[model samples]
Target: MFDINGGELIVLFVVAALVIGPQRLPAYAEQLAVLVRRGREWISQARTRLDEETGDLGVDWEALDPRKYDPRRIVRDALLDEPSTARRAAASAVVGIPPAASAPLVGPAPYDDEAT
Candidate 1:
């Protein structure tokens, strides 16, 4: 999730190398590798356990996926929708709810240059 670039990564590596001496760096690296391996194993186990627990819930996995909760896509779909029927539009006006429409025109525009 970090937005680290190559130059920044090199700087980080140089700083880490300077802080942690070369003599002990190998040992620390080995420990870090082990920690990462264990963390991955723990995550995999947790995921499997979760799947086993919820495997029979009849869940629509794709529908429930977090990635599908996109506000832009929802708004695009809403905006692209055609206008409602004439009866429904009338009902929406009566209910004070704006109708979902594509460039709906109310009536002829009032114009008078001398009114101002």
Candidate 2:
């Protein structure tokens, strides 16, 4: 995230040395390294925990990404598309049948007036 070039880094080191004094600059630098290492470790652990928690959810990354959005295409697909593979799998599961044995829905659904 930082845009520090070689020159800028050298300038920062010089300033730190001047303010903190060269006598203890090495000690301070080592402390800073330890702090940075700890921050990285914390972030890594957090990411690992988050991954473990959400790995089973099967997130649909592309569907939520605004960069690939096309309003017209989205509307068109929603209006005209047949059930997708995921939808079919879900339907099959709801019916307690294996997907391979589940038949595609044909024609209009039957109505049971008494059930309603």
Evaluated with TM-score, which candidate comes out highest?
2
lDDT of 1 by residue, 1-116 (tens): 89999999999999999999999999999999999999999999999999898788877889878988998988878666665688677878887877774234555567898997
TM-score, one value per model = 0.50, 0.56
Residue pairs clashing in model 1 are: none
Cα lDDT tens digits, model 2, 3-115, are 99999999997888899997898898899999999999999999999999878787788788999999999987875677788988999899899999875666666899999
CA lDDT, every model vs. true structure: 0.84, 0.88
Off by over 4 Å in 1: 1-3, 63-116
lDDT of 2: 0.88
User: Which consecutive 10 residues in model 1 have the weakest lDDT in total?
Assistant: 100-109
Model 1, residue 82: distance off in Å is: 22
